[model samples]
Target: MRVHKFTFAALAVAAGLTLTACQSGEDGAAQGGASSAPPGSPAASAPASPGGGSSSGGTDQSGGKNSAGTGSDGKGTAAGAGSDGTGKAGKCRTGDLEITAIDSTVGGDSDGTVAVQLKNRGGQDCTLSEYAGVDLKTSAGSLSAKRTGEHPGPVVLKKGKAVSFGVTYPLNTSGGSGVRVTGLVVTPPDETKSVTLAWPGAATLPVTEGTGSPVKVGPIGSAGQGG
Candidate 1:
């Protein structure tokens, strides 16, 4: 009877120890199998990156969309990016151009055209587009000429290269005085600044203001084409 009691007590103790070991193993396994990020890991603490962490390649970001190579409006191309992949050549500024004006025909006495030239004086390449703004400085006043041709799309002006435009005007042929043009105030396309050039020859005859303005300007073209 004493041996039976001792054996039963030992069995009970062993079973209790085995059950406790199993429970401890299960608790440790549950903790080790957790999916949550550990403390101090990047996934636990890093803030969300913008644009879903997508690379933008330096494009513009607006309205939660990428508008690369497009201006702020998203409808126009970026300033330095051209459609034909003329990358990084910016629009020509007035200060970077050298302007000159000359009579298109030699020894003109009547209606004539003036070939106005613009040379890219800057060290880098630039672009020019649209009609050049031209004003004839006359004895009467500054006579602004009207544009006459379709806009020649943007033309790349390489360093030291040049382009030309045309300005047509009816000279005084009635043996009477007409508008006496003395000089020219010229502005490049899309430019706010202007340059002044002296008229090629002796002062023009005369057509006083108020009579009528027949002066016309044309688009830019090859250096000597007179537009």
Candidate 2:
């Protein structure tokens, strides 16, 4: 009886140890699974990247294409970069002009006869007539009310245009009037859209250089014969 009891006690002890080992193994597995979970998972700790959309000063963070923006260097960049900085671009068109004069001396005027040329350069027909008034200036001050002759009727110059006319008056030669042409302007008819005429610094009348003969003062331009 003693031997049987000893055997039974040994078996019971063995079974208990086996059960403990199995329980310990199960607990270890559960702990391992909890510790090794991916980040942000139910069993994890660290937070994920700053993703899903943080924002800036009203700028979207989704990296989408913007309507009024394209990630440029923040400058004045648009359609009309060189046209007028107005973000608009178009062709520069205008009517034509021609000027001429008669002088006795090269670079000098004895009889004081000056002529003008007119034409339509704006590819289309335009109405034009010599203005009947002029504005003169001198070092002393400005002088208005200069007497001018009656100009011809409004002439329509179609496309490639040219004309020559004359100005015969003994204009006073003194002060700034000697060399500087204070003003020479042209006005387009109200029907056409045109900018204010800015005549080049050319002499409205012919100017002579070395001799007493007269030379064309200005109207420096390019010929637009071919489009």
C-alpha lDDT score of every prediction, in listed order: 0.76, 0.41
lDDT for each residue of candidate 2 in 1-227, tens digit (9 for 90 to 100): 99999999999999999999999889989787556567776435543336743233355569875566543676543553334345432222333433322232325654344334445455444444433222233232333332233434444444466544333333344333354454443322232333322223334332224433232221211111211
Best by lDDT: 1
Q: State the weakest 10-residue window (summed lDDT) of model 1.
A: 76-85
> Candidate 1: TM-score?
0.57
Candidate 2 global TM-score: 0.30
Give per-residue CA lDDT, model 1, range 175-224, as digits (tens). 77655778888989898899999887335744545655677888888325
Q: Considering every candidate listed, which one attains the maximal TM-score? A: 1
Model 1 bad stretches (over 4 Å):
1-88, 106-110, 205-212, 222-227
TM, every model = 0.57, 0.30
Report the Cα lDDT for residue 189, model 2: 29
lDDT of 2 at 14: 100
What candidate 2 gets wrong by more than 4 Å, as runs, is 1-111, 130-133, 144-152, 171-227
